[model samples]
Target chain A: MVNKENKFNDIVTDNGKRIRRICSYYSPNHEDRKDMYQDILVNIWKSLDSFRGDASINTWIYRIAVNTSLGFTGKAFKQMQMIVDVDTENLSLLFDEGTKEKLEQEAQLNQLQIELNQMSVIDKSLMSLMLEGLSMREIADVIGITEPNVKVKIHRIKEQLKSKLSGGKHE
Target chain B: MNNSKISQDTNGMGSFIDKLKREDNNLQKIFKILKITYIVLLIIYIPIFYFEIEKGGLFQVVKVVFIALGFSTFLFVFAYAQKKIKKISYAEPTLILLKKTEKRYRPFHLLDLASIPPILFLAIGLGLSEKTFLATKEFFSSDLNLSTYLVEARQFLFSGEHWFKMLAKTVNEFPMIIVFMVTGMLIFIFVISFVAGYLLWVSKYKPIRDNALELIKEIEN
Candidate 1:
């Protein structure tokens, strides 16, 4: 039991930063990202018992992280509908800084995060996994999609991001 | 409209996040209140059910047993929902947690639907038993004795003079009128409970299951 605890702790210590990055990539806000990170850690600890040698510990952890992030977004959307009456489109206008000025002020990564927020849950998971530097095979395993699908999706996501970052006026 | 255009506009994102955080906090508070209310109602209901069972006859006892089973199923769903709510971490990805939460509560929908029939049975059974007891008491206490009352009731029912007249005469002349009145009451209660329970389940619990399933598919695809 003590050995198991030690191993869990070692995994957390080694991969905690990467896990936090993944959480941040999927969650648009700081509070949500913090919650996602904690949830991922707790999930990892809880699911340790079921960890067989079927997959590497890294793949397993990635799977948990990706799935947890996706679940969180779905939950948030539902809760938002129940408790908040604000129209999302109208809410966007209230904070709109115009495309040009806003681009100049925000960091590139923050811009990336904002763009990610607009995606479907599946797309968000795929992009975040790609951003985390997971290989296509690893991403495919975590996402339960084919490696070819992952490559196609990643290429499309990059093109979309590039076009979005360059502004609609083209480079 | 496009991603880059939206990204450049970060001001809305901050306020949006803040609004969501506030809403999430309020949602948690509401859930806590609902949990407490359920516990309180359960506490109040159990003793009342026990008393009813103790005072009731065989039909009453059977009715109470079915009602108790119905309540128990609801309690199981409530307890399971409470447990899942406790396990949820607000800091995590809300979508994923929401999906799991929905999945956890899905079985309760079927349980909710199943509980309706037992409750309808309870209402019918209770009405019939109590009315039968009252009719029996009335027969024994009336000026006419049991044999005389039975003879008059049989004549009133079969005399076949216009059905409404027979009903009216039965009401005036027969001791079994009380039984007929009670049977009417039983049908009324059964219909009301069946309609109300079905409507409540359809409007409330069914949506929870549907929303969860929709979210799961959205996330998986």
Candidate 2:
């Protein structure tokens, strides 16, 4: 028999970063994030026995992560309802800051994080998945919405983000 | 190995899940204890009821029916709550999952109201059956004519008797004291139930409902 603990270890080892990143979206506090991580671990263990593999494991993990993060009620919930700061310092690498200095790039990224934090819960969830470089199909599968619905929502969200950030001119 | 990172952070994952398993077992044990308590009550009740049935009359049968109704109603509620808790699947799509979670955490369940009548009936049946508290027998007794009750109440309350005098008279009247005592107890119980229910809704269910609704709105839109 495959040891359940070893299997759980494998799952967490593979998905820990993703789960941690998702937890960070909902809880900026490190202790709370750990708590969230532990919660997701428990939930995954709860869900593991039922996995029929109808969807890919990645999609399943995403579902749990998003569901757990949204449903999460902890000391962190009221303490940190929004994404305060993520590893956005590295997110600066994703954008060509062009001639902007490092601090300016960091500032711009902070502005982006602020805008992200302002998005509705669902919208922020979608954005988080999108930022993870999941395709529309993958995002839809993970979110349990139609691919077309995901497309439309992502379109609206991107438009809202662009409008908010550019017009927001978060100096 | 990348596994080392997870081990560093979640090294106790196995032990933690074990603790959770123990806690879960404890919860299940509590549920079992509750089920056993109910069964034991029914078992004890069977003999008491059988003895009461030997002294059998209409009130005895009425007591049996009302007690059965109370127990049956509670059983249905218990089964339903357990089934609903079991049915919640975290793996469902976000929309469906939120809807289920929303239902689960609704601050008030209309189905809960179904038990009130049964409970009231059970209380009445018990009061009449327990064979003490003469006031309960009097209340449930056949001599409780409506006009007589109204006339007596009117004479007692609105008669030219002063309020303090009325209270003194009430205290002097043993039956009235018992009636007021029963009524006061019931009212106190009702008030306590209402406050406890309110606290449970506010502290536990309302926040979950609000969170679910927020997500549901976002998703549905």
| Every model's TM-score on chain B | 0.37, 0.70
The TM-score obtained by chain A of candidate 1 when compared with the true chain A = 0.72
Assess candidate 2 and give its lDDT.
0.69
- What is the C-alpha lDDT profile of model 2 across B57-155, one tens digit per residue? 877887878888888888787777776665555666778788887887776677778668767877876876343345656676646677765555545
Q: Each predicted complex: what DockQ?
A: 0.06, 0.39
Query: After TM-score superposition, what is the CA distance of residue B25 in candidate 1 from its true location, in Å?
Result: 23
Question: Roughly what TM-score does model 2 have, to 2 decimal places?
Answer: 0.74
DockQ category of candidate 1: incorrect
Model 1, B216: alpha-carbon shift in Å?
Answer: 6.0
The residue-by-residue lDDT of candidate 2 on A96-165, one tens digit each, is: 4652243255675577667766667787778777766778998888777899999899887766666665
In order, the interface RMSDs are 12.5, 3.3
User: Each prediction's Cα lDDT score?
Assistant: 0.58, 0.69
Cα RMSD of all models vs. native, in order, equals 13.4, 5.8
Best model number under TM-score? 2
